[model samples]
Structures are given as structure tokens and as C-alpha cells.
Target: AQTIHQWPVAEIKAVGSPLSLGCTIKGKSSPNLYWYWQATGGTLQQLFYSITVGQVESVVQLNLSASRPKDDQFILSTEKLLLSHSGFYLCAWSPGQYQDTQYFGPGTRLLVL
Candidate 1:
């Protein structure tokens, strides 16, 4: 069975603070990763995705960045947090293609002040 892990279950931060979130997948080899964000009471948005280590693609300009340093590791970070950044961050993995169902991690919740 595959398992996905996300760090810092939740966070509360002030504007301009540095922020970092991470996700790791186990029991899967070279799975694809996708990041998503949802604002308070807002719809979900796809932020970016990674198909391989060191290769990331952006879907929107959220002023945040993502990196996949290891085959099983994905990271999301920003130098300065904005109040608009407050929301839920999700990390999802698909077997080998986008058409496959994505399995999501526990997710990180951020409340930027």
C-alpha cells in the first residue's frame, strides 16, 4: 500500500514570515506529485505538479514555489507569507499518469495573519 506524509499538520503565521511545507510518499516508486491550495471557504486550486525528481511544473502563479529533490519527496515553500496564503495545502500522488486517481496526504493547514 502507498502512504503519503505531510509535515507540520498546521501552522499560524504572520505576513512576511517564511513558510515551508513538505510531503513524502512511501511504498510507491516514481509517483507523480501534485500540490493544491484552498482558501478559506473557497474552491480548490491546483498549484503545481512534479512528474520526476527535480522537475516541477506550475499551473498557476500563486507566488509560491515547489521542489522535488528526491523521488519520494516534495516540498512547498515561500520566502514571505501573505495573508491570502492562509488556507489548506494538499499533496497528492498518482500512480504514473494524471488520469489515475490521486491519493492525498493528511494536508497542512496554514492561517497567515
Candidate 2:
């Protein structure tokens, strides 16, 4: 069984400040990530698709960066937080297959003021 963990269930931050969000997987190694976000009262968007450590693909240019430093860890961060960055951030994992059913972590919410 795999367990996904996300840090800081929610946040309230100022614009232009730096932000970092993290996710970790337990009982599973080398899982791929499909990160996503949803704006307030808006639709969901896929942000990053990562196959392995140091192998991340961007689905949108949201001025965010993600890294998988370890097989079980994924990090998303930005040097500056924009108002547009305020949203619901979700981290999901799969067994490195497009058709695999991805398991989602408990997500983080950000409110950029």
C-alpha cells in the first residue's frame, strides 16, 4: 500500500514572497507525478508531469518549479508568489504509466494576498 503526504494543509501569503510545497510517498518507490492546480472558482489544470527524479515536464507555464530529489519526495516551489498562484494544489502519483490510475495526496491550499 502507498501513502502520499503533503505539507502545510493551507497557507496565506503575500504576493512576491517565496512559496514551497512538498509531497512525499511512502511504501512506493520511484513513482511518477502528475501535479495539478485549480484556481478559485475555476477549472483544474495540469501543471507538471514527472517520470523520475530530475525528469519533470511542464504542462503549463505557471512560473513554478518542481523537483523530485528522492524516489519518494517531490517539491514544488517558486521564487515569487503571484496572485494567480493562489489556488488548490494537488499532487498525484502513478507507476510511470499514462494509463495507470493515479493516486492523489491530501492537497494544499494557498491564498496569495
Candidate 3:
């Protein structure tokens, strides 16, 4: 059975500080992973996607970065946190194949202070 896990349920950070969030998908190899952010205004935006380990592509311009350091792990990091970056984040994954269904793990809520 495949399971995806995202860490740190929430965070409150000051502006201009660095941040990192991690996700790991077990029982799958080279899963296609995605990072999503939903702002306080209720926009569900996709930030990044990874098709394989060590390769990540940005889907939108959100001033954030993502990487896959392991076949089962994905990381999202930012050098600085912005007020506009405050949002609820979701990490999702799909089997690394065409037309597979995607599933989301419990997310992290970020509040910028």
C-alpha cells in the first residue's frame, strides 16, 4: 500500500526568514509529487511538481522552490517567507504514470507574522 506523509502541521514565521516543509511517499518508487497552496482568499494554487527524484518543475510563479532528494521524499523550501505566502499547503502524489489518480496528504498551515 502506498502512503504519503507531510510534516509540520503548522508554522508561524517572521518575514524574511527561511522555511522548509517535507513530504515522503512510502510504498511507491519515483512518484509524481505536487505542492499546492491555498491562500486565505481561497485560491487553490499549484506551486511545483516533480516527475522523478532530483527533478522538480514549477507550475506557477510563487517564489518558492521544491526538490526531490530521495525517491520517496520531496522538499519545499523558501529563502524568505512573505505575507502573501501565508496559506494552507497540501502535498499530493500520483503513481508515476500517465493518467493516474492523485491523492493528497494532511497539510501544513503557514501564517506569516
Candidate 4:
């Protein structure tokens, strides 16, 4: 069985500051990783996804970038922040099969100012 974990940001941050978030998957090698975001009272959207290490694809037009730095770890970051970026971030994974359902792990909430 695979285990996924997301690291949550536990504080508020100002605009223009750098942001970094990460997630890890255990017991599963080379799993399909995904990043999703949802604003307060807004719809959820997929931001990025990766099928292999060192190859990440952007699914949505967000001002953020995601990378699969390790076989079991994924990272999301941005050079600068914006107020509109405030919301919730979720990390998910799937078995990479087209018919496989994606499973959500954990999420982080951001209350930007």
C-alpha cells in the first residue's frame, strides 16, 4: 500500500515572498503526483502533475511550479506570492492507470494577507 503526506504551512505570509510546499509518498515508487488548489469559496483546480522524476507538467495557469525532486517526494514553489494565491493546496496521487481513481493525501490552507 502507498502512503502519502503533505506538509502544511502553519503561518501567514506576506505577498512577494517566496513559497515552498512539499509532499512525500511512501511504499509507492514512481507514482503519479498532482497538485491542486482551491480558493476560499471557489472551485478546485489542478495546478500541476508529474509521472516521473524530473518531469512535471502544468495543468492549470497558476503562477506556481511543481517538481518531482525525488522518486518519492514532490515539491511546489513560487518565487513570489500574490493575494489572489490565497487558498487551499492539496497533494494527490494515482496508480498512473487511465482508469485508476486518484487518491487524496493531505492539504494545506493559506490565509494570505
TM-score for candidate 2, residues paired by index: 0.93
Tens digits of per-residue lDDT for model 1 on 1-113?
99999999999999999999999999999999999998878888999999999999999998899999999999999999998899999999999855678888999999999
Query: Candidate 4 — worst ten consecutive residues by lDDT sum?
Result: 97-106
Measured against the true structure, the TM-scores of the candidates, in listed sequence, are 0.95, 0.93, 0.94, 0.92
In order, the Cα lDDT scores of the candidates are: 0.94, 0.89, 0.89, 0.85
Error of model 2, residue 31, in angstroms: 0.8
Tell me the TM-score of model 1. 0.95
Best by lDDT: 1
lDDT of 3: 0.89
For candidate 2, the clash count comes to 0
Instruction: State the weakest 10-residue window (summed lDDT) of model 3.
Output: 94-103
Candidate 4: residue 107 Cα off by (Å): 0.1
Residue pairs clashing, model 3: none
- For 40-89, candidate 3 gives per-residue lDDT tens digits of 76977889998988899999987899989988888999999889899999
Better of 1 and 4 by TM-score: 1
- Best-fitting candidate, scored by TM-score: 1
Tens digits of lDDT, candidate 2, 1-113: 88999988999999999999999999877788878998877877989988888888989999999888888888999999999999999999988755588889999999999
